[model samples]
Target: MPLLRSRLLPQLQALLDLLLPPACPLCGANLPQGPDQPPLCPACLAGIRPLESPCCPRCALPYPAEEGTDHLCEPCLRRPPPFAWVAALGLYMGTLQSAVQRLKFSGAIGLDRPLASLLADRFTDQVREFEPDLLLPVPLHRDRLRRRSYNQSLLIARVLGRRWGVPVACRSLVRTRDTPPQQALKADIRQRNLQGAFRLLGPLAGERVILVDDVMTTGATARECSRVLLTGGASAVAVTVLARTPRP
Candidate 1:
């Protein structure tokens, strides 16, 4: 009975797919019928601009020019970040930007799985090398979390945690206070805005942590979160985001 049920499941899913085809979340285009197919379609996938080479080794900041090798950016040289490095799926532009904004601001929670899958596919090798034991999402202040009803970063982190077989430290790091939004603020102001905003719930015994977020704009948030984690006794911290904002 179990073997028959297992064999019939695929055929049942195929039949369901034939009747009610899935649509691309980004573009609303009908997707091909297949269990193995990605949530996004080929066209939308191609539209996402990947963050390629010629980037900062530490922060993953893409240099303005397109023809150089990976090297340390000046900022990192002057003052190093708490995290060892950053991994991102693409530059925050085009389809990727749209997807992130929708997931973040517009409450498209369903986008989490597809976005996490993309990140895993691109950075699996680097993440494996890092050998992270725990995943932590940048936390939302209780007030903001109440208003938003969901933390997109936490959602993404949960998906990645399941995929990589890592434990998610969901409440270990938290926002102590709600600050003004960072979207409209300048880089220096963004840094100050997040000052003393995070608190680590308990001490970490030299665990390697991967900080997950939806986007990296000025990177002030990531830096602050990593600092707190490191201060709380985390041995190493690395950041991973869905997209990275290019330098202006």
Candidate 2:
């Protein structure tokens, strides 16, 4: 029966594909069965540069190893951001940039699972180490959530929580003030823009929490969340994100 089921599986998938063809949510390419269902093609996937070692422990910037020195990157060293620690899956350039763009702007919401799964798979151990009492995603203003109908950060937090055995509190944090987008501002301006933006919704006493976000560019948003969480009586605040844009 097992062998019969295995043999019929491909045939069933073939019928399904023929009936309703699948396409890459990013590029709209026809998605075949087997390994092809993972969304991004090999060429596109290969362009994603994962953040390997020799990175800033605080900001997660991929840095070159120097002689007998393990220190911060320029952006981290010159003016450190507030988070206690950070871990990222990859660089926010090339294919990763486009993938996030498609997911966030183009409304290709189907890609969230694969992307979040990839992030969870890579950071499962680290997520455990972060020892988050509860997973909290950066909250979107009601207006933005109404327009997008989804928050990719929460999607990622849910996926990571399931994989890492950490419970998620979806409404743990609230965005009290609706701020403009962070992508258009300089680091200093970004910091000011995000200040007093995040606040705790319910009781958060002595909990070790980690803030989950889709991207950490200037680290301002995460820092603001961390500050809010700490002020709310969280013992420690760490950040886990999908990408970190290195200084150009």
Q: Residues 30-63, candidate 2: write the lDDT tens digits.
A: 6656753665656666778988776778888666
Q: What lDDT would each prediction earn against the true structure?
A: 0.92, 0.81
TM-score of each: 0.97, 0.83
Q: For residues 1-248, could you state the per-residue lDDT of candidate 1 as single tens digits?
A: 99999999989888877888888888888887654788689999999989988999899999999798999988899889999999999999999999999999999999999999999888888999999999999999999999999999999999999888889999999999899999889777998999999999999999999999999987899999999999999999999999999988
Candidate 2 has its poorest 10 consecutive residues by lDDT at 62-71
The candidate 1 region of ten consecutive residues with least summed lDDT is 30-39
Evaluated at residue 26, the lDDT of candidate 2 is: 62
